[model samples]
Structures are given as C-alpha cells and as structure tokens.
Target chain A: MTVQDSLLAPDLPFPIFQISQTVRRYLLYDINTVTWLRRTHNILGVFIGSLPQSPQQNVFFGLPMELQPEEATLLVEKGLAFIADDFRTHKQAVRSPPRAMANYKATARKEALATAKAVTKQKQLKTQEVLQRLNVRQGTPDADNTVDNDEPDESIFDTSTQETSSRPVSSSVIPYSSTPTTSYPPIPTPSKQSSLPLPEVSASSYALFKHLHALGYFMSPGLRFGCQFSVYPGDPLRFHSHFLAMGHDWDEEIDILDLIGGGRLGTGVKKGWLIGGAVKNSDDNEKHVATSEDGQSEIGRKPGDFHVRTFCVEWSGM
Target chain B: MGDLQPSALTAYIEASRPVGVLPQDSHHHALAAQVLHNLQYQHDWTDLRIHTDSSHSARPLLKPLVSGLPPHRIYVHPDEQIEMLKQSVQEKDVPSEREWVLPTHLRETWSLRKFAELFDGIDPVPPAENQASEEKPPFPTAKGGIGSRRGGKRLMLATVGDDSTVVYYVVHDGIVKPRQN
Candidate 1:
C-alpha cells in the first residue's frame, strides 16, 4: 500500500491486498488487521454490556492474549475509540457559555442577604435561650454573682437587641464572618487602661475626645489629651472628621458656605464641639499647650511658644 | 454573596501579643492602641484617641477628629431630609448639613445607658473652635475658621475589626426623622 493508504489505515503489519482477496479479511500481516480486530472487540464489549470499566483497564477482548509491545498500542487505541464520542460531547458542554451565570449571581446576593438575616435571627434566638438559661441558673443558690468574663454582660448587650435588630432589613447583607462580638478584646479596667487624660477632663474636653473618637481618629491616651488622628503626614486634616464635616456643610448645607457655611458658631443650642486636647506647652508654667505648624504639639517649644485649640457650637436657623 | 464589600475602610489583624504587667488586666487597651495607630496611618484620620469607660462597665471608645471632613451621613432620618429640603429653598444661605458623623469605632458591646452616659458627656455641637486660631498669637483670640454654622447632623461611625476591616454605620442619640433609602 502507498503511504497515503497506510496513513489512513490503522498501523499493523500485514498484507492488505492479499487480505481483501481472502475470506477472513485478515492476512498474515496487513495494515487493516488492527481495525478488523478492534471492530471485533467492540462488538464483544457491547454484547457483554460492560464496557471496560476504566480507560486504563480497558482491554479489547478479542486481541491476542500475548501481543508484542507494538501490537499493544493497537489494542489501546481501539479501546480509546469506544469512548471518544462521549468525551467529545462532554468537552463541548464544558466549553459552552453558562446560561445562568448572571442569574446565579443575583440569586447569590439574595441568598447572602437571607443568610445574614438568618444569622441575625438565629443569634437573637440563641441569646434569648441563653438569657433564659441564665435566669434559671441565677435563681439557683449556686449562681450568685457568677459573672463570667468569657461572655459579654448580657444585661448590657441584650437590652439593645430591639434597637439594633430594628434597623431596616436590607436584603442579602451578610455580616462579614470576621466581625463578631467575640472578636472584641476584653475591655480593660479604667484606671489601668491608659495614661491618657481622665474623664475628669472638662465636659468639653471629653466631648471633643468622643467626637474625634467617633470619627475614627486615635490619640495618645497617656499624654495630655491632644487632637491627633491618623492621616497622611504634612496634611493631617486630610481625612479628619472636621474635614468631612466641612465637606458635608459645603456640599449639602451651605449656600455661601465659603468657610463651612459662614454661619456663626454657638448660634444653635447644645453644641458638641471638640475643645482643646492633649499637648505640651512651651513654658513650664504655660497653662495652655501651643500647637506646631502641623497642628501638633510644637516640636520644640520655647518659653513663648503658643498652642492651637478648636471649639464648636450647634447653630440653627439659616 | 454578591462578593461586593460595601465597607470603605480596611484593617489588619495583628497577632495577639502577651500583655505583660499592666494593672487591671488591661491588655485590650494596648491592642486598641495598636488599632488606633493603624487607623491613623491607613485611614488618614487626625487626632485619634481611645477612651475607655470610666465606670468599667462600658466599652472603650475610638474617637476621631472629624470637624470638616465629608463622609457618610452619620445621622439621618428619611423624614428629616425632606423637611430640610423643603426648608432649603427659603433659607437665606445654602441648606444645613443633616448628619454629624463621628469617625469612631467600637470593639465591645454597649448598653444604651452607657451610650446615653456618653451622649450626656458630649455636646449637641462639637467643642468650640480654638484649634482654628493661630499657632503663636500673642493673645488667645479666635482666628482662622470658627463659628461656622451647620445643623446637629449625623455621625459616621467607623467600627474596626481585628482582621483590619472597618464596618461603617450611622448613629444618632435620640429619635430623628427617618430618611429615604
């Protein structure tokens, strides 16, 4: 046979011309012998109703029991053909675009929100159960003053459940798993916590601290209380709450808000201004600490160095 | 989950360290201090401080100095926004800002009574504008920008997690008109 005919035919060593002329369609050595053998085996496999259980284990039943290595390749190739159609179909299915991906995402968001809600509900139920359990335990003589440090004070946390859960039910808002009541480190005692100024700091001082605290700024608790929050250096006020407040005024409230609504401070009643904070004064006797160029404690205060202080008031009526 | 993280702030959880010899088992204060440092560097906040409860029955406070920043409407009632908008047209100047958000964080569970205690300590408006004055003025006269008028607005609360993620929320002391979604 020519190379073209041999390429098209299964690799085998036999006489093709003589085989066609003969009855079994097989010659002592012919290129089409493997094809004929595979067709035979395929028939037997289908007949047995159990295709070779695995690709690796597949053995054409009619192949010579003991074939040379070269002949072994032919038998394996034949077995591969039996399953090629199924493999091709699977591949095409995998490559095709998913029909429901978008729908899946939408459903996922809904599911997440549902899960979050469920978690909240479950937590509430668990809390109620624990509370009841506590009440019963407390009634027992052994339960007196058994304040467990491991658990949150349910009285404080439990009372707010109605208010906290009452928040509008937004769909699919899963609370990040990392956030939990457990994650909060146990709070420290007041006197040992920080060297920071005491609550004894005037109402205005404490108020400023609370306002800044709420705004995500942190300061040195040990030192004289100072207004210091995290921000890019050189421009400390870049993300300061004051900056946000000003923007809110300019964007939403002020008409001629050239400087945060040219409205006068203290025009409104009950202000929550952030008065002076912790800092070092220049003079040993300097009652008020002066500010540096960056609004921090002066780098090196001379006897004459001054301090910076911020004050605010709530104003109403245009 | 839609996989969209709505939180604007990010955080890192430092491995818990041994609390050496601080009195009153105050290791959490040190952790909070570390968190405060991270917030200042990462979130661009100024004048951040941690205030623990004096009564020991309350949680520690993470306070930020946000006087002029623009963030979420810390406090809002959908109903209040409409009233403010209606009044906006007749106002002499621009309308007043609605919420006064504080850039703060919470790590412990809080009671409303404790919250009220905190609220009681705080003024409806922020402190007076002394920081707005000059650094070395011969006299303690008010300078720069002070007395700027605005409403008793909402406060943006940035609650930090140990894993370095900050979940933000809006909070108000008393009842205010509700806002639209």
Candidate 2:
C-alpha cells in the first residue's frame, strides 16, 4: 500500500503533530490518519492516551499514538507525513470567526433539542405501556378504560407527567458537543517561523531504522527492552517483537560486556539482539556536503544516504 | 575463603540500615544506598545523602530517595534552554542544582500513579546542600549562582540492573516542552 491508497485524502500528507519538544513527544490524534498509517504503512506507534472505560489501568490504552523520532523522521522522508507544531496550530484554530462559532452552537442546540424531545416521547410511551400492563395484571376487562379512568393510580402517571413537563425544552443541558465541532477552521499551514522540521534522530540510528523499516518490520521505542528499537515481524498487536536492536557508529568501539548483556537479555525473552551501523564510504563526504547544504531547510534526509550493516546475536546457552 | 573480607559496600549498607522499618523495606534502603554509593564513587557525585522521610511533612517516603549534586547538570528544561539562548548563556555556565534521585531495581514495574505520589512527597528541587549528613563537606556554591527560575519538579530515575549497572533518566512531574536537538 502506498500514499495514494491511504484512507485519508490523497493530496494531504498525514500530519504528525509535535505535542511536546522537551521530551520529544510526536502524537497523531486523528483516528483516520492513525488507521491509514497502521494498515497501509505498518507503522504502529504506541497509543499513550488514557482508556476512557478503565482510566486507572495502564494495561490497555486509547488514542493519540506516540511515534518515536525515527518513525516520525521516516514518515516525513517517505512523503507520507509532515511534522506540525501543535501549539501554533491550536492557537490559530481557537481564533476562528465568531460567525462560525455561532453557527456551530445553533446546530448543536438544534440537535440536542431534538434528542430531548425524542427521549420524552419515548418515556411517555413506556409509561403508557406499563400502565396498560398493570391493568391487565389486575384482571381488568378493559385495560384502556382503566387507564382513562381518573380514579386509577395517579402516582405513576403524576411522576411521568412531571418528568416530561420538567424536561428542558432548550438544549442547555448539553454544555459541549460530543462530536468534534466543525466550527473551528482547518489547521492552517504553519508559518515558516512556527513550522517544525522533522524530529532529529542520530544518523546511525536513523540509518538502522530505515534499513529495518524497508524490510517491512514494525519497530517501537526500545526503552523497555533496553535497546534502541524492538522490531516485530508484524503489527505489535498480533506478534511479539523478534529482536532488540541497537545502533552504533560504524567505527565506534563495542564493549564486549554490553554485547553479552544485550544477547543474554534478548535470549531470556526469546528474541535476537541485533546491532548495526551505517558503513562509511566515499559517498559519506558527499552526504555530509548534502546535509550541510540542506541544513535547516530540508525536513528529511534523502533515501539511500547510508549503507547499513547489521549483525544478530543469540546466546548459545553454553 | 576464611581470609575473605566483607566489601566496603556491604559494610556501609549494614552500618546505614534505616531504623523502625519492616524487614522487606530494608531491601529498598539497601538499593538506595547502593545507588548513592555508585553516584559518589563511580560517578564522582558530591554531597550525597539518603532521604528516608519526606522533605515536606517528615512522613516516611514511599521509598528512600538519594539526593546529590552531579558533576554536570543532568537536565535542562526546554523553557530554561530558550531563556539561556535568549541571554546568549552557554549551558555549561549554568550552575548544577542538587537533584532528587529515585532508586529502583531493574525488575520492578512502575506506574504513573506511583511516580506521581513520589513526586508529591518531594519538593520541586532537592535542598541546595545535604543538611542531614554532617561529616560530608558542604557543596561549594557555583560562582554565578543557581538560577532563580527553577523549572517544575523533576527527579533522576536510577534503575539498577543486577550487574551493578545503573541507568539514569530525568523525569519531570508533568508534560514539559521538548528540547531542541
């Protein structure tokens, strides 16, 4: 699946909003965009939203998928998404015209009033049915006559009548719309001054991420697994991660103990410990030049910028 | 085997055992002390002290916390960074503040509520000096002085693996602005 086949409009790149800069939180709140990214691109960013049903429990989560920096960078590079500064867009959205706000309020009020009326009618019908049933149980020959009789049980009818009468005719009960209101203008393209470039990731780590991503593996932040990335063969929902991947500079010294610890940990969890880096080559100088030229102007790196080499380690249990 | 001696860490842990706590709680005290030991010797931290009670109410803390001044500032709040950038002040020039360190075992599972409770028990910033420990010399105040506008409450989470490897992460009380790379 490609960008053209996305559920979202073909022309619009999925917007990955930078929710926070200090802790580097990139979030996607739009359900459609999240679904498209998951189904089409196999990008299963972690859902960090609190589940409404069980707000206290952390076993399950809801919405606002949090993407790792590598995932965000990859999506931007592939032209599948763009980073937007959420604070700026939100400020712009709140400044919508008063006319639009009034129009939305009117529509919302109308809908609420209709719902209130329907609920009252339904309640009245239920009361009538119950009254008729009570009369039948009392062996009344004419249930309808019993209901119409003024001497019949007035308590139930009185309460029902009072409830219907007390029901608010206006839609003041609803303080806000349950659905997202269309009154706010669409998020505008951020001005250059406020625009956010793609999230920055280490060159070697990004290279490793790009390499693994191209192989159709789904990856997530590996803080829990004590590695740079935990890679799964399919959606995390359906499969366990198969590897704990760490990225290092090509010429950087490898600590033997770190390799052993990673391997042992991975083996304990039935996964491979993988290490990799971008191999330095003559094209590296050109890449540096390209990076310098694009500095602060480009949102993502060009494809095929780095040649990555990877090794997977599994403990022999000797 | 007969000539073997107890290591300094073991001896220190024995000597510093917290009083009037459950036997299991001693394990946590040991963990905090171990982290403190690592920070002082391995990491060259100064004015290290183990906190058994809340700084605010004097109630016993959920777990012992270690307070120390690191050789360098472990975190720079995004807003603080922006302020420094505007003032053209280099980050290194900023005085390092004493930090709260929550020590945990690598095997333990943590939740947001637990973290929030921990944050509530502590102050926004650790006390400037270790007032509880008298033997240790007071940390010398930096020449420029610590900034007045200290950011929100934060702590350094130190997870100690079985192999004696301690990994530290800076955790703030709530969502903070992201720092530039």
Candidate 3:
C-alpha cells in the first residue's frame, strides 16, 4: 500500500494523523529500521514482505500504479528514502542499524548473561570441590596409624593455589570475548605521521578573535590557543611537494573551505579531492588571483581575495 | 525536557571520551560518538551532541543540530513558494539549489511529545552564534551586523556508522510555508 493508499484506507484502526505521526516518529528517530518494520506493521500504507537486500540502490515508490502490497512496499521505500535523503542532505546523519547490528545486543546480552552464570557456577563448584578435598578426613585419625597431615597439607596448599589462580585467569578471558569488537583502531606510531599545515595567526590577529566572537562565531578555544600554520614569508603563497601513491596525480591542489565562518570564505587548506577556500592575502596588491587554475570562482570573486588571513593549511591523509 | 536539562549535552561531552578531530590523534568512544566525529570533521559543524538515554525511546536515531549559516535557502514559506513561482515565470536564469544540510549523529529515540519539546526549545531559525565558518564572502549587510544575528538554519550532519554514511536534515520548530521543490 502506498502512503496515499493507507491514507485512503477504510480499515485503518486509528486516526490517520495518529498513524502518520507514529510513522513520522519512527522515520525521524528510529535507529533500527528492521525493528521499526516488525513492530509498526501499520506505519506504511503497504507492508514490505521482506526488506530489500540492497538498501542503497533500491528504489521505493517508483510508480504509483500497482497492487496494494507492491504499492505499499514502494510507499515504505519512499518514506525511507524521504527520511534517508532528507537526513543525508541536511547532514543530520542518524545512526541506523546495519544488518549486523540489528538485535545483536539483545542476543549478546543473553549469551553474556548465560555465560557469566555458568562461569560463576563452575567456579563455585571448583572451589567447593577444593574445600571438600581439603576437609576430607582420611580415616578420622582414630583407629589406624596416622601419617603426618602436615606433609599432605603443604601439597594441598600448593595445588589449591595453583588451581585457583589458573581458574580465575581463564574465567576472565571468557568475558573479554563477550564484548563486541571495536571498529576503530588505535593511533599509529609518530614515524607514520604526515604533517598537515596548521593555521597560525599572529599575536596581533587576536584582535580579530574578539570581532568574530562578538559576531556570534567563536573559534574553538583550543584552536585559538594552539592553532599553528605554515608561513610563506614575503610571498603570499608557498609551494610544497609530496610524491603521490597509487591513484593520486602530481600537482593536484585541493582546497577545503570553511563554509560556516571567516566570512564563509575558503580556507587555503585543500587535500586531494578535498577542496576548501583559498586564503586571500589581504596585502597582495597583484591583480587578485582566482582560486582555481582556470580562474573560476564559485562566489564570483577571486578566491584568494575573499577572506584576509595570515596563514594557510593543507594536509594529505595517505 | 530539554530546558530542564540545558547542561545535559555539555555534561555528556565531559563524561564521554574525546575523539580528536584529526585522524591521527585517535581516541576511543562508543560507536555513536565516532559517527558524531565524522559529521563534525567532514562538515565543519558544531553542537554535534547526542542524547544516549533510553527514556521516551522512539527508534534508534540520532538527533543533532548543525550550527552554521543558512545553507542555500533554508526556510521557504508556502506563500513564498507561490511568489517564487510567479517571479520565475519571467526569469529563466535562476537555478534553485536545494539547501545543503550538514550531517549530525543522534543516538536515542524520541517521542512526539519529546519532538514537540525539542522544537519548543529550538528557535524558528537556527542559532546564529554557533555557525560554521563559511567559504563564501559575507554579504555587505552581514559585515556590519553585530551580536548574535541569524546565523542561518540548524543543520545536523549525523553519521550512522564508522564509515561515512551521513544523513542531513533541516529541522524547524513549527510549520512554515512550503517552497516549490
């Protein structure tokens, strides 16, 4: 059923707005689409028999003409796309569950709890056995000739301590496996580091900070306190070279602009395929140079002349 | 609810682990925070906060607001749409650019009551002060404008995972006139 169909349906148990509002709530905030699908069967006008395997390329609601089921699936797809595209365009990337993440926590929690209980029981049984062995009386010291209990006592202590230490360590290892493996890796060594050009402003530039702040845009205090930049000295621009690996071509300069502040001008920091604003030398009297090689500026001004700043920043990840 | 806990977001950041903006200064956070970092670094957005609590849960979605100037034309009233349509009847050169919304990652569910609550706390327009640095030249009027002017719309660039799968949205407090798509 298409969203339109559902709106037109006679069998709707709830008010259309109630259902629509519920659907909107799920679309706007639901993290798990599959769970949303299963729980809110009536959210879409038509129900999807099963989720399409390829979500990225799959089209929903392509044509309006179809049976109720097909139309409903398409409508659901449209709703999903509407939400997804809206989110993508606005950059409000909400966390949706990947197929793997779906219901993983619930099952994982169950397994973890089960394993923990079993481990506790196992440990308790082992400790009890040890105690039983230790407390076992060999013929109760009455009738038969008694061997020195101290001799066996020393061996028992050594064996029990060894068993106790080994059991705990092994038990701890089980819990580690129960935790989900992290996706992010730790920081690499310093030698593997490639330097990114830091933006540096002179002590005099501190005055600009106040003006910017008063204007309702603030630099991160960390950036203000410690931001560094590459100085070009007398020349307004500097050229640095690095060898390209694999697909990168030589002489490719990409500029990334600061679109939110600094007059919304491009910063002089561009990586490969990553374009930004070029820092305009306010002092450069030479006919204002355009940012691009072809001299085309998106904003119709020389990119270099758009914003006046002291330094430029650029970096490459690979 | 948001007003009751104005400092909630700040406290969340304080308590959570710090993930550096640059890739090199690696740090650990929950899967959600890492996604939030991608939105911030790539989009140059601010106020990328997420609420992790499970109360009033809706679906698993991230709610974050972008802090910057209005990207393209943010708000289009329904009346304005008609006006633009009439104006375009004569002008042929004007090409409409859909607003570029920044991505944000929110990690909790929200109910209608909560959504209404969030809308209540937010302004009809985006907060001006926390706006991202723009690459475009400031309009002459903006140059002289002083203290806390309209920065633009609230753009939230939210990331769903470790790899960059971002969704952007422009949220409004109440109904506004719709623009011609």
lDDT of 1 by residue, B31-111 (tens): 454544544565454444433332233443333223322222233333444554765532223222222233333444433
Best by TM-score: 2
User: TM-score for chain A of every candidate model?
Assistant: 0.21, 0.79, 0.22
Deviation from native of the Cα of residue A303 in model 3, angstroms: 62
1 or 2, which is superior by lDDT?
A: 2
What is the descending lDDT order?
Answer: 2, 1, 3
* Clash numbers, per candidate: 114, 5, 78
Tell me the interface RMSD of model 2, in angstroms.
17.6
lDDT of 3: 0.31
- Which ranges in model 1 have alpha carbons more than 4 Å from their true place? A1-318, B1-80, B83-107, B128-130, B133-156
lDDT of 2 at B147: 51
**Candidate 3's residue-wise lDDT over A180-275, tens digit each?**
443212211112122111122232233223222222221222222122111111121223211000111111221112211211111222111111
| RMSD in Å for model 2 | 23.2
Which residue runs of candidate 3 sit more than 4 Å off their true CA positions? A1-318, B1-65, B88-107, B130-162, B176-179
Q: Write the per-residue lDDT of candidate 1 for residues A92-163, one digit (tens) a residue.
A: 434444555455445556666676788778877876687768766665665555656214446457556645
lDDT of 3 at B97: 19
Interface RMSD of each: 17.1, 17.6, 20.0
The per-model DockQ list reads 0.01, 0.01, 0.01
